[model samples]
Target: MKKKIRIYQSINTKIVLVIVLLLVFVLQLIGANFITQIENQLITSFQEDRKVQMDFLESTITSSLEIEESGEGSETSPEQEISSLLTEFSGSGITDLQVVNSELIVMGTSDTTQQSTVGQLSDDVDLRQAQITENSITRQVIDSITQNRRWKIVEPVFSSGEDSQFLGAILMESNIESVYDQISQITWIFLQSSAVAIILSLVLANMLSRALTKPIKEMQLQTREIAEGDYSGTLKVYGEDELGQLASLINDLSDDVAEAQESIDAERRRLDSVLTHMTDGVLATDRRGKIIIINEMAQSMLDIDQETATEKNLLSILDVEDDVTLRSILEKQDDILVNSRQNDIPIILRASFSLIQRESGFISGLVCVLHDVTEQERIEEERKQFVSNVSHELRTPLTSMRSYIEALADGAWQDPDLAPRFLEVTQNETDRMIRMIQDLLQLSRIDSGKSMLNLEIVDLTEMLDHVLNRFDMMIHSAEYEDKKYQINKEILEQSIFVEVDPDRMIQVLDNIMNNAIKYSPDGGTISGKMEKREDTVLISVRDEGMGIPKADINKIFSRFYRVDRARSRAMGGSGLGLAISKEVVEQHGGHIWADSTEGKGTTFYLSLPYFPYEEEEWE
Candidate 1:
């Protein structure tokens, strides 16, 4: 949005104001000097005119005094002649004129009000000063009664002789206020003319200001539009001047800015797309280690929302502050493991760090990429354990076989009793090793998805009966005479048909039955139950034997796991039966689990998905 400019703040208004101010200042200075010179000239001319008039009147009075001395007085006395001369010479400017004789007495006066003092001795200070100095003296004073300005001039007259004698003096009072009034009138006229000139200057200044600011105002508007991301408008160029060139430059700048903005927008969108789709979590932090950028994957890995994650310290988010500091990570630039559990699920992440540095080798921030490695790390650990278990399992039997073979080679074979027993023990150890290897290979195939099931439709009732009958046959035989056991079968009378690989299913049953028989006491009963449910057929083998502990029950199906390692080994068990059964059952789209009472018994159940089908259709 374009901001509104105040009238007082506008460039146009400022230009107008500056011009008017400068004109006023110049006029003030000129007027002061002009008025001063005019006042001085007027005062000087007024004084000079007064002096010339006073000198002429003094000479005429001196002539009157000489006539009286020569005894030529006829129609008028010397004093009357002097007074007449003074009255004749006194013009518009003269207020009063008086003639005093050499005795300091006023002989005659033009002022009627002062006629009484004309015959008396004149005590005027100017007249006394004129008599003493024997020269003309003048002083200006104000009238006490009228408060009017007056110029006083006293001229001493001398007798015409080789030694000039002071005869009398002529005193004149001139009203000089008219000279100041004229000067004031001229000053008023000058002020009127100056005001007219100032008004004209104001109008001219306004026009010039508008002309100077028009282009600038247009440019300002266009620039404001450009700032608002509207680059379509261009400034009008009035002439080939600085303003015109500037307008052209602005148009070019707008184009450049628009292109740069588009490019930046495109790059930003591309970055967002890449960050959204990336598999690994990405995080970026500023130099202070506060998170500035975090992708969705990073948010998920950290179990944080964007609002919570932004500006949070990187170490705090990763929860590795106790182990490492930001400086350590930056200096090492190494990968670290983050182990966190959210919602009771363990999450393991491998975070790799890199520096977000400038070309000048200044490090600005750090970038961390997190790849989830939970499943991979678990597999790696299981692989190592599997290898160690296999090594130990094979080594035990191999060592036993080697021991017996060496005994026979050292002439123990010659002893009839020792030879048979040692050979039998060696043979048993060899068979155990062979069985363990076969089970390992079977598990490997199942895990690799190479063991395809030979599926067939079989009646689950008959399948359970078949497995039970085999165990029953084993129990009845002389080989199991010492360890007597009973097999109890609880099969659904109605034939329950299921889709399965018959051989694998039999193997699974064999594993459960053998475990039950091995753990049960000599007179223990092994109960096998089968039930037809809505969507699955469940088979459980219950053994009257010491049950698995609660803690180890979940791990009973793991490879190479045994509750009693010494007893299992002594019983010629490879410890892979349950693990193999679990894998096969899962491959067949089934689940296997166990339930046990610590001192009473354990039940192993296998459930396979089942759909109700017509028996006739399967036949």
Candidate 2:
């Protein structure tokens, strides 16, 4: 946006003022010099005319004084003739005229107001000086009464002889104010002409300035319009001068800018599209770490709205300000695992930071790419846990078998009782390890989706009855003589046939029944049921034993997860039965879950797809 240019600040006004001032200064100097020379010439000419008149008056007065000195008589006395001559000699600019004798006595006077000074000693200093020195004297003075300028002249009259005698002196006073008045008039005329010249100069300067600044003003308007995204206007070139060349440049600049604008807009749209479709959340910040641009993915990942995220500090928005600072991130330029929660659900984000730097190596801001790593991190953690559990489980059995084998090898075989017992213990541990390894391999295959089920149609109720009969037989066997238990079966009259992998389905039921028997107390009844539910059949195994905690019930199906690790290990359970059962049931298009309460009992349910089948077709 262009600012409004004040009239006084405009280049046109400046040029006009500069030209006018230069003219004024030149005129002032010329006028002063012209007036001074005119005044000097006028005064010099006036003095020369006054000197001529005084010389004429002195010669005429000398003839009259000499005649008196020779005692010659005339029609009038010498004083009368001198007075007549003085009166005739006096003219304009002459204020007073006096004739004095050699003795400095006034002989004649022309001023009527000073006629009484005749025959009196002349008190005029110039008159007395002229008689004593026998030379003329002239001086100009201002009259105190009229405040007018006057010139006083005293000329000594000499007789015409080889030895001239100073007869007397003629004194004259002349008003010379007219000389200065004429000089003043001439100066005034010069001033009037200078003023007119200055007026003319001002007008010419304005015209010249307009010619020079017209194209410049147009260029200014054109540039302003270009800045406002209007590149249609072109500056009119007035001449082939500098301003015209500049106007041409401006026109070229507008064309270049229009092309650049289109290119920039296309690039911006492409960038916006890329940011919108990016799977990874991306955010950009200014040098101050304030969020400048945040894409939709970034907003979603951060769980922030566009309005709330704008201009907000990036670290604060990511909730990592306490642990990480912008400077640290910029300096390190490393990826940060940001542990955060959105809507109370814990999530992990891999925030990769990079510097937005210029070619000059100036760090302008930071760009952060946020990748939601919550599921990845969870899977990674589970992998680590699985490795550790497998190591520990293998280590326990291997360590036990190693101890028993070492005991037997170290002469324990000499004692038949000790050797057989150690051998038996070693074999049992080896079997446990083998079973664990098999379960681990099976789970790996299932997790990798490489396990295939041998699908078949099977009677869900008959499968449940077969699983219960085994548990019933185990309860009455000599091995469980001390631990009393009972089996309660609720089988539906109409058999529910489900499409399943028969072995896998039987294995799933075996895991449930075994868990029930292991956890049941003496005389505790293990209840089994088969029922058709919607288009599926549900088989539940209930145990009257201390149940799993509600918190850990959901996680009971995870590989190697045991609520009581010591008790489960002591009972020789591999802890993979339930995990395997879940995978098997799910693979056969069935679901398995457990319902439990602390200090109560647990019910494990398995639901498989059910279909009404005609047994005669198979027969």
Candidate 3:
């Protein structure tokens, strides 16, 4: 469980408390001293008043004594005169007044309750001390009988001569309770004032602390907003003080941070756009060779998950050797060609390395750009093979023609039979060369997308029949005098019409028939079939001969591809027939494919969009 904090513990509350406590302490100190001084002054004033009264009574008594000695008032006794003077001073604020003689005898006292003490020896210690010293003495005492606090003043009355004799001591006592009452009342007033002062101090301190802390609290809230990624808030300045200056700085900082964040976000968006649309794969790594940034192209090319690849080692993800880390690549500063595979298909990637460096020349990381050159490399290899195959194909017939021409020139023409045969052989070679050249030109046009088709609706059944009839005539010619071959046609009874280039379609059919004748054995039968589906016409040419291997079936339609190179060459096949046929069919918005079994036979299929036939058009 978390502990809860109290409001009094907050800075504002603490400040208020501190200010109040200090004020209270100081006020109490000053009030205590003031009260003490007032009490002392009051007690001193009371003592002075009592001393004046005692001096006056002493003067009066001394005057009376002188007159009595001079016989001016001889009728009155000296004790009676002193007693009447004491009586006069008794009720004049003094609690008690006494006149003692030189023998320590009680001459007179103003207290009526102490009348019996008259004419008795005074045992008062104040009087004894005053007679010995012959000086006035004052003392404060608590009355034992009445338990009242009082002041005692003793004055010695002296004669007016050079060696004055002490007549007696005048002892006076005054009750100090009135002075104490005034002090008590003043203390109460002081206590009440202190209480009021403390309350005012607390209220003033609270207000002052609140005024000081309000701006700080607002700044705190603004800072919190900034921490939460909102840099739009600005602090309000309270005064031209340090805290106000801090608020101004914070406001400026917020604006600066907001601008920096905007710039950073704009840069990030631009970088993302470039990475998203770029054709080449891009990968960035940290100084430690850990993956930091990877684009979609990189993920697709590397066959790795973007989320999973992040923070992983770059070399490990690329499947490169352990020594081929990003650090090593950066150090080498060279492009690397990585030969890798995806889904068992060979892929060649050209990876170019660049250093991500700081202005201080410190190498921070590496940037690797990967370009997939698999198709480019494959095309290059194919061009080389095409050139080689064309050279070999042309050289064969050219070599034969050269040899035969030289033989005829060497007098073989004189032998009539040998000359005609040699001429015949040269003509055949010339024809084969012409056929090869024609096929090459046709394929070149098709590949360049320059082949134009003369499209027309043709009767599919009639077209097949015409091609089959030509092959039937060729089989009975001198080329098939010993080998017996047959053409079997299984076409639709109803004539199907299709939109195609008739010449190109005838060429396509003738090429398929020639291949069938070349590969079929002596007595093998060739089957040709045409059928009309819902919206298309399907044509199939099959032969009972050596079938194509499944591995080479997909490549059979490629230019210069041959399952049996030697057999095809011996049969004067340039290996471009089916490739040309595929192009022609596709140019007519049709498709062509082959299906063959190794030990059974081979079949070629061609599909074209079917054209509807009307009776009026046929008429």
Candidate 4:
């Protein structure tokens, strides 16, 4: 029977049933309480009315007894007065009025059979209140005769107010059965009305329940469709209640999810575009080392077809070069993008993955990406080779000059008088070649980013002084050197020291000064000066040279590049001074540039950031 019921089959029906049951239970409880109260009131009202009637009879009987004692009419006994009182008691809604004497005799009654019962005495009558009260009492009394039938009331009559005298008790009983019958009829009407009300409530409840559940049922079906991966369309809802609002939200959510999915699909396609046509290879892996996805490029790099690569472990498929930077990136963190090349073909690749967590944040899967860099590597290699070739070209001349100076020093300078003259000339030429070779080497290392600078504080004034002493005799002679630099003022004691690589910077300054001397027409004024700016120091070396043409200023720093090669070689120039100077200044985190105009002087200015080295290291 329980199995046949299908309790969960109809939600609306069940809810309606529950509502109707609860409403009916409460309504019935109220009706029962109402009926019980009304019945009690009816009984009390009927008994109270009967008590008044009995009191009237008692008063009349007591007055009559007084009259009898005074001899006003025919003097009657107590029993006779009671019997007359009972006989006179009359009302249509009442019946079976009777009276009894103190002796418990049936003196008289409205009906003869009831009078006979009166003589027997009513044991059910609550006589205690009457006995306690001087006047009258009223209460419900169960029928003394039939047991089921009820009576109204009875009252005892006293002889007089002053004297201790006994008078008969006047019992006036009314059936009140008709009032009870009327109440029964009304109760039947109430029951009928309650039945109608219950039926109506159940019907309304069922309708309400259906109205509530209809949209919910539709939404439930739609949700199942969504769960089953149906993104076809959306559900439309009616009305403006809570369920309608819920439907609107679901519709919006579905649209957003669909749009988001399309966007994701678009991104995947874009990624595929880059991966499929690229020359180099790419491979991706999951947290468990399984291949989650791979671009065609990656598949090609590993030398495996896509069909064969799916579900394979990444570590197994990848043919990564032993010393590639990608190995460090991949081994460092769990799921960040790392780059690597699988073979010597020089493929640049990026891989990214994540712990694919569910809503509860449990790790589930991983993802990765790839790229190619063979062309890039080739270009970089060409640049390095070009720089190396330039360095070798500059070194050969310096090497030849050094060998001549060595041979001249070994035997040619041994004759005492010729020694001083030959040694000085040889020393000057050797120094010039040594200076050129050292400048070329520095330029090569700086361009390759292979040189490390000693970032320390050095006195700029003292360094300049030491270099100045080497040229003191030339500056003082002024005849053969033909150049004289005048100290304009007392050189400022630059306690304003800067963080610099002094040796590298000296090489830079010396190159610029040599070029100035080499290119300047005879008897030209040359100048050197230093000034501090907001965050850097500027050193300027200027000469009134045969000024550069406008178009050629940009190319002056190109290697093995010279303006008027014959004139530069005649002045013992290596054509690498300005080029090397640029490299050294840039390596010191500084800038060097030339400003020249037609027939005007050229100024090479070098600027370096004022690095404060004395402050404590934050690291």
Sort every candidate by lDDT, greatest first.
Answer: 1, 2, 3, 4
Across 364-385, the per-residue lDDT of candidate 2 in tens digits comes to 9999999999999999999999
Ranking by TM-score: 2, 1, 3, 4
Worst 10 residues of 1 by lDDT: 64-73
Pairs in steric clash, model 1:
none
What are the per-residue Cα lDDT tens digits for candidate 3 across 101-164? 7766787888889899988999988889888888788877998998888888888887777877
Q: Candidate 1 on 319-371: residue-level lDDT in tens?
A: 99899998899899889999966456889999999999999999999999999
How close to the true structure is residue 517 of candidate 3, measured as C-alpha lDDT? 90
Better of 2 and 3 by TM-score: 2
Write model 4 residue lDDT over 1-619, tens digit each, in one string.
1234365678887888888889888878988898898888987777777766666666676665455445565656655775666666766555666554444344556776555565575453444345445345554456656654557566665676787454445555566666688789878988898889889988899789988888887777677666565666576687888889999888887777778878988998898887777654555655466776777777665556777887676655554334333345345534332244445354544444334557986544444544444456556765685577456554655566566567676786677776677667656667767866676677668768788888777776666655545444454574645554432212446555666788777877677766776666666666777777778877777778788888988878876666676676557776677777777677777898888987887887888887544536522
**Candidate number with greatest TM-score:** 2
lDDT at 68, model 2? 80
- The C-alpha lDDT values of all candidates are 0.87, 0.87, 0.86, 0.66
Those runs of model 4 whose alpha carbons end farther than 4 Å from true positions after fitting are 1-26, 29-37, 64-81, 88-96, 102-106, 114-137, 160-164, 176-181, 240-245, 264-619
Error (Å) of candidate 2 at residue 370 is 3.6
Model 2 reaches what TM-score against the true structure? 0.81
The TM-scores, one per candidate, come to 0.80, 0.81, 0.64, 0.41
lDDT of 2 at 509: 82
The regions of model 2 sitting more than 4 angstroms off are 65-75, 98-109, 117-140, 151-171, 283-293, 304-334, 342-344, 351-368, 411-420, 454-481, 484-506, 509-513, 516-555, 581-619
lDDT of 2: 0.87
